[model samples]
Target: MTAETLSIPGLAKPASRIALGTWAIGGAMWGGADDANAARTIDKALDLGINVIDTAPVYGFGHSEEVVGRAVEGKRDKVILATKVGLNWQGGKIFRDSRPARIEQEIEDSLRRLRTEYIDLYQVHWPDVETPLEETARALENLVKAGKVRALGVSNFSPAQMDEFSKFAPLATIQPPYNLFEREIEQDVLPAAVRNKLVVLAYGPLCRGLLSGRMTADRKFEGDDLRNHDPKFQQPRFDQYLKAVEDLKGIAEKHGKSMLALAVRWVLDRGPTIALWGARKPEQISGVEEAFGWTLDEADMKAIDTILTRDIQNPVGPEFMAPPARNRVQGQ
Candidate 1:
């Protein structure tokens, strides 16, 4: 299987269009995870030609980075390490904090956890309304100047925020929640990235497993699984999404692919994007190769829209995943 590739301006090698996402490997919110399994999963991704590993400190409260560090040890040069700053957590509560001091501290911590001298793609995890964009951008700019980071990117940022962020730093990419179910970015965020010539790291390509073809009506989420809180998983909405997923099965079968492959293929065919595929176990990523080497034409695209419109009466975005701001936490 030939995976599509994208070239970032400063990176040494082209990155696979399908990036390995470590949010689930963190094992904090998505039920639980095992370190050994996480390591194996990372190794499997690398073996499959997936060089981009996207993780964050808040993921499993630093556990994810530690696992990634150990997994990529001695092979650091082969992987494109993409991690994030901003969003501080305390007592299981997370809030956005992108002050210069916070960013400065976060980079060192990230480097130590990732066990790397320099981060290939260092991104601000979210927009901090409390901190001025210039301050955060300049702080990231200094990292590039000091050789601690190679490129800068932002996640969950609006076009206006990117405009302000670019003034102080050369923005290379943007990470946003995007999938077949949630397409809020199509209105403005995607257009802005195109205008700015920024590569898009489209996360949640499977809609948090809803489109993966594994979910069933009787399946249950345990512990603090974030899916339990997702609106789409609730009644009525859940049934609507499931029906759409079932209807989408024919499209997948017509293309001789699994629903997971079809879902991710749809994302890549939408635009210039690197679809982030989240996994905690090696088997979960087994069919990743299927997502490549396929393109959905205009008719397929139109049929997908028709199925979604016919099955889903109400649609929801991934806004529920956003962490609260510092001010909101303080008020409580």
Candidate 2:
């Protein structure tokens, strides 16, 4: 299907598939992060015909937005811009703040940093437990009313939370990490979104590069890298994940696609609004773009589901929290 056919709240659903995720465009792992590389990545995606891009102010703690702004400087209309608020990542730390005042301030800051007056799909990166969900919802609704954001959405929200938040405003989309290794959202979050007719923006669809079958090199990350500290990539569980990656490769080969391509296609095949693909390299961007020409067949999906096995084995419960190279059960 083409972006024109894909209908969502505010963003232009791409007729072709593949939404570029700008997180790594700011360089999360390989430290070559700079304005030039980021701008080039965005330009490359557009040239390759990828239209939708998902980002957040916390990514590189606003550095990502700056690069995105400069990259889309002249061709903003050609691409769909999606960004988030709530969680602030600054000085290598994450803190959630959804107070009315902070939300208002962040919206203005996001507009300035993005170099655009309106954000296509503005989302709350995460729920602020301290702030009443209703208050946060109203703040986002107010932004819409003020014409600051075209659409309002949320990320990493639970089914119950999604329903609660929607009462205050019309939720256009909800982003959650969904991949072969992680399917928690499928159980609750997805049903809620579908019931409400809200778009499901599948983030981390490639499992932070683990599903790409490139882990054979045993590449190591820096101390601050999230994957470096993640339990799934740790030696104890690395082999298991490596096995899963190989399964992806095998399945992709049957379809004449790469593991990366298959990984993206699986998510796209799921009934959702879009998949947020993170690509630091130009080649990765191209590979993701190729995943949308068609959908995966049932037999392929069944075998894939069987082999991928829901064993994230994250010591910290979620894939994002486990310490790097540590056992999923912890201290293993």
Which candidate comes out best when scored by TM-score?
Answer: 1
lDDT of each residue in 135-206, candidate 1, tens digit only = 999999999999999899999999999999999899999999999999999999999988888999999999
What's the TM-score of every candidate structure? 0.98, 0.89
Model 1, residue 332: C-alpha shift (Å): 11
Cα lDDT, all candidates? 0.93, 0.75
Instruction: For residue 200, give model 2's deviation from the true position in Å.
Output: 1.1
Q: Which predicted model would earn the best lDDT? A: 1
Model 2 earns a TM-score of 0.89
Worst 10 residues of 1 by lDDT: 323-332
Candidate 1 lDDT score relative to the true structure: 0.93
Give the TM-score comparing model 1 with the true structure, all chains together: 0.98
